[model samples]
Target: MSLSAAITGMGVVICGPKEIPDATGNTLSAISMAAQEAGIDLREIDGLLINQNELIADDHLTLDLSRRGAFGTLKVLYELESKGTTMSVLLKQATEIVNAGEADNVVVVFADAAISPNAPSGAAFASMGGDTGYRGLERAGGMLGAVAAYALIAQHYFVERNADIDDLFAVAQAQRSWAVENPLAWIREPLTREKYDAAPLVAAPLRRLDCARPVSGAAAFIVSKPNSSNSLNPVYVRGMAQRHTMRRRHAPHSPWRPVGASEVFTDALKQARTTADAIDNLQIYDAFTIVPLVMMEELGVVGPGEAGSFIAAGNTRHGGSLPVNTGGGQISGFYLQGATPLIEAVTQLRGQGGNRQIADASTSMVVSVGGRLESVNALVMGVQQ
Candidate 1:
């Protein structure tokens, strides 16, 4: 018999550079408050998970903020590196630890500050690929490389499907409209089709608006076993899958080759015993607009190269047939290294998502990709036992 774990509480703190001088301190406070709100005492927390890039040391989980009294004394069982794909791994680990009786409750926290030293240069263009020194794709500048790759795929997709650029602009404009109502989002200014068209191209065929912004912030959540009478409802980790592909630089010289995303997503759906139609909402990691566009095909949300039409028909916006990225996604929402989508999944399942909450979102799918599209993790989460 497998033991079950559920999320009991959540907290978020998104501060611009001017709001908090110490990013770590703000993150600690956010996690602590979120735990308290969820009715868990700080002392009751048996494990801590931190995913901030700067705070992660070689082998130790530092607790400088705790010594300063932000959170009470507690055991820090495990600490993982902060990467785009760390959140899903942390969630799996936390659940396993709790169900295994190694811990009764676990607190996972993540925070980032734009002012932090070693912040990636050329924030507009970053790559999922770590430093490999590829000829055309620079390591630190891989973000741009990803955009370039996506633009290439998008252009091919459009040409193959005979879709117009106006369809893509409609998706951007709709997400921007949703961003206006989300106070936590970084880019809330309403986007116009004209503005999206006029924006300078970051990479060929990829406009500046198509790329995600680098915003500073933190978010935290508490997980525990379910009790019959708990105040907060539970969201179960129904199924999950992860896969890795050959590094892009090492792959065959065919740009038209199908990436490995479709297999991973399909396996996750099969493991969950659910179909694409069963998913009420989706929280795909959107480092670039094309990321979700690719996912739309890979996840079977639409047929090959049909995502532009799907978006142009207003199918991905709120109240659409398949609502997506309700928290404005990384393109507009706080970018905490891809953890934001996981946090949003929890919030949406708990019915705590304000303003952007889907009408009856009981099940959500979160897909995270990392390392030059080499690694992928997919999770099927739901508000069920």
Candidate 2:
């Protein structure tokens, strides 16, 4: 018999605008909570997986984009005083380690503290300049950062699809509406189309609300053998898939090229032996307003260029056909890259989402993106029967 991976515990510490804790503090708190919920002592954890360590030092947010390379493993283990084996693995590999019997109880932690008031300016990061050698070219062309890059896509999308900027406004408004229900959300106020239009434009068609807030927080989850879980709801990892075929590809042609979201979602669903309709909830990555739109098209949830209309029709909100990012997502929720969506999916599947829980949500889908949509990964999780 093959082993299956299931999430038995989860912990999230979000730093709101008024109160922001250090990354190290948030990380420890998150780990302790997850371990407690998993019915295990902190010292009993045998495996550790860390995503990123965006430490909050002197009220400044510093992120080691390499996810701390090898040093991170040593630091986390030392700080936690754990005798467990430690390894840094991506989303898909974490589940594999547990399923392969290499680890019985694996705890994955991700801490980001980018919302501090004294955080470094956006120019301090090289990725903001563009990828490596292209930095100079992008800078010379007046492309400042991520917003500029996605703005280029937005421009092309509008021109090709005859879409309006109002679509972007709708996405921002929808996310805010969802955020209102989430206590951990940073921005919970209602947003109107008029308010969205009044907000300053960061990049041409992309308004300030269109971009996700880089807040400070940490999230951790326990992936263990299904039989080891004692929680009221054990969320099993039904399927997982990732595609990196376009990581090296750049813009202009990149946006028009086929995206990995399609293949990853299909492969994950097939591995789960289910179709998209079975997914009761979706926690799609929301780095920008356009990201989920593109994903919806590729995921077959909506036709190409019709995501705006689909969302406007309330297909993604609570009580809609497919509730998406019911816990505010990265846009209105904390931006921990893909970790935010992963945590949200687990919470919903566990039926512990409070006001954001989808009615009878037994199956959930989560997709994450990295490197400006260069790489995409998808995971299917279900409430274990």
Candidate 3:
């Protein structure tokens, strides 16, 4: 539905592979950075939303988040953790609160330090309850985490389409090209096919390069009523929708099963009075190399079993008809959960994309596929002229 809110400014702090002092502090600083751009002081923020991902990063403060931050008396405050979809959910909730006049100048922030020196490699997500779900069916799968999970989907997808596995690396290579141009991207080096093959295997089909590089990063966004005097060239929310297509604890019938992606895509675009083809850019929350294809196939952007060929044909690279993850996405860029795509889209729309900016691009469609691909959230945004 059309939202009567606009994003006024945003802030991001990306650190190296090590932990920074009070990772939560990074998030707070990001808020200050964003609020400054919005022409608002810390005391002016009446609402605050923070995505506390305990599973990914143990650095987040619990209820004491607001007390320890640089915010004022918050009329609305919540610390949400809904896997990766938390960013959009926070944004949507902030918009509603602003539009309803419950609060003004709300800021949503997210910070993570999953792959630090303190935490073992992949320790943050190693405890994920594999695809067996709540049923606990004896699949001999336990603590397989996300890489193994997506590998399962890739195995099914590639086998079904008889698609070459090299296409997966092609996506990594394509995203790396964009990352090469992104100053904030962690992996700026080109991902050659040889390097991909040489990379250590995370799962059967996924290599180290195929997975998102977890890093210590934080991002914050400020939103207020549409066209407020304090706002400047604000980004208006065109449409937003979210759907959870999963049982509470049941595993999907198929690994590549379509999660309510089409529903969110259709509803959000319809509310925006636009179509998928009209979208100038796509910012997909891609945690793995195969996610883009799964999303494209599920969204009907390309025919079933055809998304691989589409990307391998350079359809998603810069200067193509459609640029998916033009800012390198989470796979090649640093993984800050849903904040990766959300902030990237905002950066592009603000005409600050630097070398990776898409020319004449005014509209962006961001999709956050969360959980075990169970929750799908789609949002359409347009930059006000």
Candidate 4:
């Protein structure tokens, strides 16, 4: 018999300082508290998974006081330590542990502290790979260079398709408008096309406002048996799929690239037997505005390169036909290591997303990327009746 798991609890800690100033501690505390509030005791948790830019010092020291205090007695089924490792890998590990019955309940936590590398402003982008060499270093380069590459892609998208710059500015304006209503968002101020156009460029064709925030925060969730009484009313993980790029990282340029996000999304829809029209909401990762723009095309929501026009039409706004990033997304919402978007998707499915809630939301989709666009993972979540 196959065992199923569902998220029973969740917690968030953003824009604050804490006793455990390190990212790992803050993340653990956030999810622990959420799980406790949802009725899981810290001592009762059998499995723990943590994701951060750096390893927790406590996890290393033989006589570390914090390690003993935090996870000394628990049977840690899985432990991952890497920076810029995709959230999909983390999610996959946790799911396997739960499926194996190695633990009855699992806690997944992700956090990142304020990261300002010693490298020059644009040069620090290379740090995404942590301290590894070669593949890791290349991955880091991809992270840092993403802004530049995305700008190039966005520019090409517009020029080849005859899209006006105003269309892109309009997307920024619409996202900001939604952020204004979200109190937890890092940037809640209303934005204007004039101001957006005037903002200094981070990269040619990409302004500062068009880029996502570099803020630090943490988020967590508790996964347990689907039938557990502690589970939320609905919001079960129904389908998931992950795909990697066929092209190797060494290849500087390849016309036939691997990691097709569109393919993963379509596979997820197939597993869930859902169609674009059946999806009630979406939470595509917006590391940069261009990411979502590409997703819009791949997801078949709109024609290729037409995401700017589609977004400008107001279909993605709160009251629009399809609501996205109700929590302002990484663009406006606090950047919490990419896990927050998953939390938001769960909130919407449970009908508990206050203020930003979409009316009668029954199903939602989540898309996340890792490395220099080498991997894509998509999940289809819905109310479990």
Candidate 5:
């Protein structure tokens, strides 16, 4: 008894390193924006799902957001932590709960204090998995952090496909070009190929520009029936799919092929009753520059070993065959995981992307990768015809 759902309201607030230090306050403000856009009182929201991994603090925020008034006695409130793909999972879960008549509207919120001074570095993630023997294995090989681990993958991708590192420059610069037009984007300074090439190396093949910057920010949205909202334009959630590789070390390595994206993308498109050609825009998880390069190949946007060449040719840039990460993405934008990308997708669909908006854009695809490519999730979204 799966139910159909649409995004009726969305809110986003991004603070820079010097701006503010309130993650909870930003999240509440975002939630208020969404409630305002949906033209619904806070009391009308019956379901609330917060992605715990993206939050900087306690589980009390959910209650705080819910206690404003009398919620539907059938309210649903919970915290979820699924790494980078938590937002998509929550979307699917909220839709199911709403369809079951247990809740009429579901509010999903995500906020992160990644940019906080005390936050751990990206290198830290690479070690947390050490408990599973990966640390010892990596230590034995002198590979210490996420940058080191992914650098190994990038090296493999280059050798196996005979690709050059310059291709990554193309990917980074393209996203930066889009970021320049995005006011909310963190990295707005022009990122040139020359600048990228000369950037300091974090690992052998991975440079400072290859990784996403952890920034404090918050984003939220409301999921409800299309007819139940006050908004004139609603983006329907056509389809979704999630898959995981479990142990990435055992997975095959390839540039044009992703670990689990093919299966997930295929299932999502099939469920949406659409094809790759129908998508006018793509909001890929660019946690790192290499993520989108491999995803483009996995989604069949380019042939095997053709991603580097395809990107270098500027086929994925704005005003090209396919525009991606129109809002700069995780690398150039704040790293709020999938939450930021999801908000950008909604912006594109709503025609609110003033400068970076795709012309006549109606359909968009969002893909989120987590756990060093071990987890993949995709969503097919479109405006109601």
Candidate 6:
């Protein structure tokens, strides 16, 4: 496949809950690290793109702060925002900028300091809508938070597919298996089915292990022309597509159906001029176990309602036919929204995944969904040889 843009560099920063760095600190550090890996001078980075977490203060994370704190001047700068769809969208923007000759190198960074002591993630998530008027109504109806919202989706999926708790357990177990190999993973201990089954329920049908634990950290990647000699490893972007299914219009008819994912994944593959068979690894935004499970089926590589069983059969673990979320995914890894998936893909594509690396993983597919599946995006990438 012809490459449009490729990730040349990447960096990560982990901060403890008490020492949470503001968006600027995280962004500057991560971007500087990425720039060095790309073999480019900091001043040569002409573009800066920031993906601020929904929970962070917008005023605190501005392009002005990023520029003043790091790169003095840039050809392009912008702060991208969304609940979970920011990663792929930011990448697409960076690709467009480079491909159009607007900039030679664009650093995409996601910096978040939302983690707070004794704060419930659900409560913080509820505030992301900017206190929109609908928030009151949603909360009044016992929607509670994202966890509760996803639990409803999980319930619908279970009934439709005849799946039980064991299916969810498999997803969590496989992720933990990978996490044990990831030094950055927050929880790397083996996950027993017994423990998964007995974990305290955060939302009905969704246990504590099912949801991604929020962490304070930053991740950044440098995007540039594919196969640039400046990079030790260049993970090229092959295809990209996005879709937004109006939930109000489709929820009543197909609340449980992942129709949007099917469309987006297919379009992405078409854009890459490749078949699904070429995708050897996946780095999907798995905020919850069922999220990727449903995506596996919706992507059509796995049969409908069979993703749970597919995972249970050990097809997604390391050394399996299609190792998924090789960095343990968001469920086991720290939750950084879309960056969680992209980071793993870049590492594995660069042959830097270490113990969790998939064997000869040349191509990887990435998927990110936003707001209870209201919006979705997919990207196909290949390791530049």
Model 5, 191-296: lDDT tens per residue? 9778888888988777889988767677888888766446657777788998876664443554324566788889999988999889999999887788787788
Residue 161 lDDT (model 4):
59
- Where model 3 places Cα greater than 4 Å from the true spot, the runs are 1-3, 19-21, 118-121, 129-143, 226-232, 247-253
Cα lDDT computed for each candidate against the true fold = 0.70, 0.70, 0.81, 0.66, 0.77, 0.81
TM-scores of all candidate predictions against the true structure: 0.84, 0.85, 0.92, 0.83, 0.89, 0.93
Which stretch of 10 consecutive residues in model 4 shows the poorest summed lDDT?
56-65
**Residues 218-316 of candidate 6: C-alpha lDDT, one tens digit per residue:** 888899875545657787777899887766635455685655788898899998888888899988888888898788888787887898888888899
After superposition on all C-alphas, the RMSD of every candidate to the true structure, in Å, is 4.0, 5.4, 3.0, 4.5, 3.3, 2.3
* Per-residue lDDT of candidate 2, residues 220-301 (tens digit): 7877765544555667878877766544556545564337667888999998888888999888778789888777877788
Q: Across residues 44-106, which tens digit of lDDT does each residue of candidate 3 receive?
A: 888888887755535664567678776678999888887788888888788778888999889
lDDT of 6 at 315: 93
**Residues 52-147, model 4: lDDT tens digits:** 444222222122222633543555544454333345456656665676777777777766554333223234343433556664664555534457
> Largest TM-score belongs to which candidate?
6
Decreasing lDDT order of the candidates? 3, 6, 5, 1, 2, 4
Arranged by TM-score with the best first, the candidates are 6, 3, 5, 2, 1, 4
Q: Which sections of candidate 6 miss by over 4 Å?
A: 1-4, 58-60, 117-123, 226-231, 249-252
Residue 102, model 2: lDDT of 73
How high is the lDDT of residue 313 in model 1?
A: 85
- Report model 1's TM-score to 2 decimal places: 0.84
**Taking the tens digit of each residue's C-alpha lDDT, what string does model 1 give over 1-385?**
5438877777777766455335566677777766766577777777777664632232222555455434444555545763566788788778777888878778877766543444542342343344455623554544444666667766766676676566567667767766777777888898877778899897767787887766556677778887654467878777788876665444363343336777777887888788878898888787767677766776677887688888878888888998888878877776666677887788788887778888778999998877445567888888875
